[model samples]
Target chain A: MTAHTSSSSSLGLISSATAISQGAEAKVYYASLHPAPSPASTTETVDVLIKHRFHKGYRHPSLDNSLTKSRVAGEARALIRCLRCGVHVPGIRMVDAAEGVLALEWIDGKSVRFLLGGGAEGEEEEAADSEDSDVAEAAAQEDDTDPLSEYGATQDELMAMVGAEIAKMHRGDVVHGDLTTSNMMLRHPRSEKGLQLVLIDFGLAYTSTLVEDKAVDLYVLERAFASTHPASEPLFASVLRAYQAGMGREWTAISKRLDDVRLRGRKRSMVG
Target chain B: METYHYPSFPADASHVHIALFKNVSNAAELRSRIVRASLLEGSEGDLEREAVNFAFIDARLICSRVHLQTAIYQAVLAHAQGALRTKTVHSEILWTLNPSNNISEAIRRYGVSDTTAFLIVVRISTANDANVLANMQAVVSGELSRFSLEGITDWASVKKYYKLNSEPALKIQGITLVQERKIIDEIVTSTVAMKSVMT
Candidate 1:
C-alpha cells in the first residue's frame, strides 16, 4: 500500500481521540501529545485544537475542494495576522488544507456566553439558584468557587473584550465576517492577565478596510448579544464604549454606520 | 548509534539489518544509487533495498536526537502498515515533517530542499531484538565522514522550493540570523509533531 493508504487509515486514530466541538463550517476536536518523556515530564501532554473540514455533500467536488482549501488557508492567515497585531488568538499548530483540517492551541476555558446567562449550561441556572447569588459572590471573591467558575465571565467584560478585539482586528484591516458570543470564549484566569476573550470560527473572515464592513461586523455581535443573552443592553453599551476608546477618530464613522446598519439591518441598500 | 524499540509491535514482525556506506556524496547521488542498487540481481536487490530501507533525512532539519527519534518512530509505524499518505517513501519523509496529509506538496516543499547536506537514512523492517542494537551501532559508526555545515547547503534552491522569501516568520523585525535559524528549526519540528492533528 502507498503512503496515502496509511494516512487515510490513520485518520481513525487522529479523529477518535479528539473531543469534538461543533460549528457551522467544521467540527473541532481537541488534540493532544501524550506520554512523551520530557525534561518537565509533568507537562508531557500538550493540548491542541483540531478543525476538520468535513465533506459537504451539497457542493460540487471541485468547488468544495477550492472552498475548503481557501477557508483553511484564510483562517491560518488571519490567525497569523492577529498574532502579529498582538491579538490574543490561539497559535496555529498545524494546517492540512488538502484534508481541510487545522490544529491550534487548545485553550482551557468556556464560552463567554455561558457565563453571561446565555444558553451554555441550562442546568447551571438551577444549580446557581440552589447555591444562592450571595454565597456564589462570596465564593467568587474568595476564589474558591468551582474550578471552571473563572471561565464564567460577566456580560459586560465579555462585551468589552468583543469591542477591543474587533477594534484591533479592524485596525489591522481584517474583517471578522462572523461575530457572536457563542463564537467567543473566556480562558481560565490563572495569572494576573485576568480574563482573556478568544475569538473563534473565522470561516467567513477576510481582509477589508471598509468602514461599512466593520460596522456590520459589530452589528452582528450586537444582534447576537440581544438574542442569546438576557438584559444585555447595558452590557453592549459598555462594549461600544471600550470600542470607542480603541477605535480613536475612526469611531465616529463606524458608530454612525453602525447606527444606520441597526435601523436598515445588515444589508445596505445596494440600489444606487 | 542509537536504537529504539516500540513494545506494541508484534514479536515475529521484528528483524534487524544494517549497511554502512563510505563517503556517500550528495542527496541526488545517494537517491539514484539506492534506486540502482535496489534494481540489482534478486538477492543483491533484496540486500541493497534492505540496507537503504530507512528514510535518509537531512540531518540539518533535525533538532536533537530525541526529536529525530520521534519522527523516525512515527515513520516506521506508517511504513510497516503501508499507511503513508504520500506517493513515495522519499516524499513520506516530508509528509512526516508536515502536520497534514498533503504528501506531494510536502515533498515538493521540504524533501530534498536546496540547503540539505548531511543525510541520515532510516529503514524499518522485521528485526531480531538481539541483533538490532548491534546493527544500528555498526551503521552509525561506519566509514561515513562527520559532515560539516559550512561547506554544504544550497540556500537559493531551498528558498525557491519552500517559498520562504515572503513568509511572515522570516519578515519579523529585529531577529538575527541565528534567531531566524532557530525559529525555522522550531517551525519544522512543530510541523513534524503536529501530523496527528492534521488531516
Candidate 2:
C-alpha cells in the first residue's frame, strides 16, 4: 500500500480555487487536490470539488448532528455504489463526516445551470469574457449566440443525459433525494470527445428500493425544472423519454407513481 | 501482489501494495496473541514490534477498492483540509478503521492482531518512482522475510475478526478467493494513501 502523509501545515489551501456553491444544506467549494506521486505521472496539478455540509442554525443540536453525519455518509456510500454499478458519478476522493464535507473529482466544464443562464453572476461574467476573447480571436467566427450555446447540446439533449444517468442510478437502488439541472453539469469534455451530462450533489441520496422513493426522486427534479426554467415542460418530457428507455419495464410503475406524487406534492398527504 | 493508486495527491501516491487472505479462522487467537505480545518482556517485545507492523482489517465491512479508497481518501482530505482528529496520517488509518474517536483503542484493535492474514503494509514517500519501486521490492523480498506472494498470510484470523462468515461483498459477488484477496489488498492499500493527510 502506498501511503501519503502531507502535513496540513504544508498544504497551503489555495483560496483562489475556493469558489463556493451554496446548496440547501451545504456549501461546495471548487478546490485543488494534491495528487499522490506515481511512476508514470509527470505533473501534480488536480482540481476537486469539496462539498461542505455547513452547520444548520434552525435544527436541534443532536438531530442536526446525526442528520449532517448520515447525509455525508449516505452521499459517500451512494457514490461508491454508483461507481460499482458503472454509472459515471464522480469518484469519491475524500470524506469528512464529522466536518460534514466530501471532496470529489471536479468536472472541468460548466454546469447545466450555467450553460442555460442560471449560473452565478460572477461566472456569467467570466463566461462572457471568454466569449469576447473567442470572438476577438476570429471576427469570421463571431457567432451571435454565446460560446457556451455553441457547445451544441440542445436543452433536450442535456435533459436526456440527466434522465438516463438517474435511471441507471435508480436501477442500482440508489435514490437521489434531490435532483436539479443546477446539480447536473454538462462537462464539454476536456477534449472534443468527452462524456457530458454528469449528475452530482448526492448529499441527500439514500439507498432504497421503495417505488415511492424513486418516484419522489423524479418528481423533485420535475418540480425543480418547472420552477427554475419556465416553459421547460417539453425539455423535461424529453428527459423522461430517455429515462423511460433506460428504465425499461421499471418505468411503467415509476411513471404512474410520479403522477401520484405530483398530485400530492413532495410531502405525501398523511391525511388520507 | 495487488497494486493500488490514488491520483489525487502528489506523485508518490501512485505506488501501492495489497494482499488479501480469506477465511481467517483464528481471530480470537490472533487477538489474544497480539494482546499477549504487546505485554511481552525483553526480546519478545522487539520480535512482536517487528512482526506486527501491518493492519488487520475485517474483510466483511470492505466493499471494494473504491469503497476503501473513499474512506482513506476522506481521511487524507480531512487532514489536508486541516481536520485530522489524530496527529499523523499513519494513525489516521487506525482512526478510520474504528467507528468512534478513541485514538488508542483504534490503534490497538485495528492496527495489528495475531491472526491477521489480510495484511497490507505500505511505505509512502515523495521520492522518485524508481526509488519507491526499489524500496517496495526490498521491503517485500528482503527485510520482510515472512512475506511471500504465495505464503505469508494468516486468513483464519481475518475472517473471524471481520465476521466474514456472511457478507455480500465476499459471498454473493462473483469472485474467487484469490480475487477476493486482491480486492482486500486494494482496499487496504487505498486506506494507507488516504491516511497521508492525517494529523
Candidate 3:
C-alpha cells in the first residue's frame, strides 16, 4: 500500500518532467529541484536527472513491482559504494526506491561516446552542428562557449580517467556490470573539478569481491570500446595501463584473469 | 531564512522553511523543553509542541547547506507519500542523516545536544505564513544569520560520524583537503538522499 502511494507520487513527478530518453526498463528525464528563477535573477537552479523504472507489462504485476523496487535500491547502493571508493560517479539527489525513481546530480558536459565521435544515432543531428554562427549565438546566450571543448581533455587523457576511475571502483569490490563510452561523462570545464570523468548508469552494477568479476568488468568495457570506437586497441591499451597503475599489486591477478576472459567471453564454463 | 516549494507534494506540505542559528547558548534548555513537550497532552501539550516544531539539527555535523537540504528533501518526500518511518517529518530529517537505521541513535548524533553551539532549524509546512520566521526567532535564543554554508561545517566531526577516514575517496593521492572535503560532502549528502531505500 505504501509502495503504491509512493509509486504513484513518483509517476506524477515523472509525468511533469521533460523526458530525455526512453529505454526498455526505464525512462530518463531532465528535472529541477527548485522552481524556475526570475528572468532577471542570476541564481542557478539546481538541475537533476531522474531515472524512473516504470512498470513492465510483460511481467506479473506483483513480480514487476518487486523487481523494480529491488533494482532501484541496488543501483543506489552501488553508486554510494563507488562514491565512498572515490570513483567519479554522479551523486544521488533523491531516491524513491519503492516508486522506482532515482534522481541524480546532472553532469553538465558531453558523454565520452559523443566526444569520441560515437554518439547515439538519435543525437547525431545535434552533434553535427559545428557551424560557427549558431555556436556563437549559443555562446552569447549561455556560459558554455563550445559543448565539445567544455571537457578540455584529450582523447588519451579521457581514456586514462576512465581506466583509473574503473580501477578505483573495482578495488572497492564493486563490479559495474555495464561499462561503455556512453555511460561515462566528462565534466564541464567550469565545474568544481574541471575536465573530470564521471561514470553513470549503475542500474546493472553490483558488489563482488571475486577477481573473475573484476576481470569481466574490464572485459566488458574493452568490448564496448572495440565495437564503438575506430582504432580502439591502442586506446584500450592505454586504459589498461592506467588501470594497472591505479591497481598496483592487485592489477597482476586481474590482468591475467582479464586475458582469459577476453578469450572465453563473459560466461565461465560450467561443464567441468 | 530560505523557502523551497516542492511541486510534487501537496500544497499544504510543499513549503519548506530553513534557518541557521549560530551562537546557540540555550541548547540545553531547548533540548529539555522538547523532551517535556513530547509527554504533554491536550491543548497545553499542543501549545508546547508548537513552540519547538522545527528540526533542531547540530550544525557542526552538517557538511554543507546542500547536505542539510538533501535530508530535509527526503524527509519531506516520505511525509508527502504517507510513508514516514518516524512519527513526524521533523524527526525524520534527523533519522535520514544517520548512516544506520536506529532512530534514537540518529537523534542522539544529529539532533541538538546540550553543548550544541551552532544549529540548523528546519520546518516543513503547507502555507508560507508570514509568521513562520517570527515564530522561529521567538523559540530560538540564538543569532539568526545568513544561510551561507562556508566556515560553518565541522569537517573533523563529519569524518568521524561518517567513518570517512578509511574511505578510499579520502585516501586518494594528490587530493587537497578542500577537494577531499568536497567529495565527502557530496557523498554524505548523497547517502542521506538515498537513506530511505538503503538496505
Candidate No. with top lDDT: 3
Model 1, residue A40: distance off in Å is 13
- Candidate 2 stretches with Cα past 4 Å from truth are A1-17, A35-41, A55-64, A119-143, A146-152, A191-193, B1-121, B124-199
The DockQ-based CAPRI class assigned to model 2 is incorrect
For model 2, residues B1-199, the per-residue Cα lDDT tens digits are 3344544444543334444444454556655655676688899787874454334444444444344444555555555555668765545756776544578877666654444444444433233434433433432321222223344443554445444445433443466677566434433332333332222
TM-score of each: 0.60, 0.59, 0.91
Q: List ranges where model 3 is wrong by over 4 Å.
A: A1-8, A36-44, A121-150
DockQ of each: 0.10, 0.13, 0.55
Q: What does the lDDT read for residue B149 in candidate 2?
A: 36
Write down the TM-score for model 3. Answer: 0.91
Model 3 lDDT, residue A262, Cα: 84
For model 1 chain A, the run of ten residues with the poorest summed lDDT: A33-42
Model 2 Cα lDDT, one tens digit per residue, A1-272: 00222322112232334756564777768875554333333233445787777668788867887887777777777766665454556655555565565667777677776666554324544556697744553563453465466567777677778888888888888888878877787777552226567778776788899889999999888888787776878978988999999899999999999989989988887784
- Give stretches of model 1 more than 4 Å off: A1-7, A18-25, A31-43, A57-70, A94-100, A121-159, A190-195, A244-252, B1-137, B141-199
Higher-lDDT candidate among 2 and 3? 3
> Compared with the true structure, what per-residue lDDT tens digits does model 3 show for residues A45-76?
66899998887789888888799989989999
Instruction: Say which candidate scores most in DockQ.
Output: 3
